[model samples]
Target: MKSILTILVFLVTFGSAFSQTGEDKHPLLTDRFIIGAGWYFPTRDIKVEVAGDIEGLEDIDFDETLGLSQGDNTFNFVFFWRFSKNKFWSVRGESFSVGSTRNVILDEEIEWEDITYPVGGEAEVSFGVALYRVFFGRVISSGQKHELGGGLGIHGLNVKASVEGEGFVGDTSAGFERSETEAFLPLPNIGFWYTWAPTDKWAFSANLDWFGIKIDNISGGLWNVSPGVTYQIIRNLGVNLNYEFMNFNADIDGTDFRGSFDLTFSGPSIRVMGNF
Candidate 1:
C-alpha cells in the first residue's frame, strides 16, 4: 500500500508540472507593433498635347513627351499596430510615407515658320503619403514554428506633383513653372507574408504589397507595388531589401494645352526596420 501511494503521488506531481510548463511555452498568436523604413525609386514618362489653336495658329500642336529613367531615392517609414492576432485571423492599422523625384524630358517639335523646331525640355518631382490603413488577414498555414498569411487593406493617400523648366525658342531663353497639386483619396491594398523561425531567438520574413489611388478632381492616379525580404537581427530589429514600381498620370488644365500626359517609374530600394 505504501509503495502504491508513493507512485501515485509522484505521477500526479509530474503531470501537474508538465501541464504547467506546456501551457507556458505553447505557441500564441497575439497583438504586436511593427515599425520599419523603406527606400523608393521612381521613373516616369509624360505625354501632353494641346487641343486648341494658340495665337491664331490653326491646327496647332504642342507635344510634350517626358521620360524618366533614373529616379531620385526617397525614404519611407511605417508603423503597423495589430489589434488582434489569432491562429487564422489578424487585424492591423498602418501608416507610411514615401517620396521621389523623376527626371523629366520634354520633347517638343513645333511647326512654326513652316519649319520644325525641336524645343529642349526639363524635369519634375512627385511625393506621396499614406495616412492610414486598416487591414485583415487570414493565416493559411500555421505550425509550431512557422506562419504564412495573406491580407487586404484600405488606404488613404495624399500625393503631390511639381514642375520647373527652362528651354529655348529660336535661340532665346524661356522659363516655365507649375505649382504642386495635391490629390487625396482612398485606395485598396493586398499583401502576403511568410514568417519562419530557425531557432527560439531568430526569425525571418518576406512580403509583398500592392495599392493604388484614383483622384477624380485631378484627373490622375498613382499606384505602387512593392516586394521585400527581411532578416531579424534581434527580437525587434531587422534589415530589408525592397523593390517597388510607382505610376503617375495627370492632365494639363488649360484650353491652351492640347495633349494628354502620362508617367511611370520603377526601381530597387534598401531599408531597415524595428518593432517597439
Candidate 2:
C-alpha cells in the first residue's frame, strides 16, 4: 500500500512539470484499443456456516481448516477500447482467478452434510473464485492535460469450495465424506476515474468503484481501485506499471450452502500495450 502511494505522488509531481494544453497534446485524449497481461499476488479469507438441514456443526474457515497459505501467485488480463468517433466514451473489461487446495490431518472434528469427520482423520479442502468485469464511461471533464470520468459496471463472480474426508453418520457407512458449495452472482457498481498526462509520452491514471447492499436473500459489498503510470515508447506502443486492490464480502443463502465469504487481493503488475 505504501509503495502504491509513492508511485501516485511521483506521477503528480512529474506530470505537473511537463503537462501542456492542446487537442492533440496527449495520447489518452485520442481513441485507442489496449490489451495487457500480467501477474497477480493475492491473499484470501473465506468462511461458511451450515444451517437448515445440517446441524451440530461449526462454521468452516478455509484458511484455518484447510491450512491454506496466506499468499499465492496468478495471472490476469485486461481489454479496453476507446472509440475515436466519441473521444468522451470508452469501454473496458478485466478478468482473473485464484484458488488453493491442501491435504492435511484434521485438527478437530467437523460435521457436514449430517456426517462427522474424526479429529485424527485425513482431510482435503479446496477454495477458489473467478472474477470478471465490464464497464462503460463518458469523459465528463476532458482537458488537454487531464480528464475525469464516471460510469457504471457489472462484476460477475463465481465462488466454489469443497471439503472431503473420512467420516460417518446415521444409516451411512464410515468412508469418504464430501460437501461443497457453488455460487454465481452478477453485481452492479458505480465509480469514477481520473487521467493525467504531463506530456504525450507519459501519463498517469486512477480509478475506484464500490457497491453493496442487503436485498432479499443476497447481501455483500465489493470494492476495487487501481493506480498506474504509462510511458509511450513509440508512436503506438507503451509500457505500464500499476497497483490494484480488491476486497469483497458476500453472504448468500442458497439451496447448496448458507454462509458468508470474504476476500482481499492486492498486487502490482507490469505490462505492454499498443494503440491504433
Model number with the top TM-score: 2
| Model 2 lDDT per residue over 1-276, tens place | 999999999999887766654346556557477777777776666665555456565777778776887687778888888864767788889899988888879887766656777787888888888999998888899876788999999889888887788777754757887877788877788988998987887899998989997888889889999999988878677888888888878777876657677777787777777776
Model 1 C-alpha lDDT per residue in residues 248-269, reported as the tens digit of each score? 4444343333333344556666
As for candidate 2, its clashing pairs are none
Regions of model 2 farther than 4 Å from truth = 1-24, 50-59, 108-113, 168-174
Error of 1 at 254 (Å): 14
TM-score of each: 0.53, 0.83
Q: What's the lDDT of the predicted structure labeled candidate 1?
A: 0.51
Report lDDT (CA) for all predictions.
Answer: 0.51, 0.79
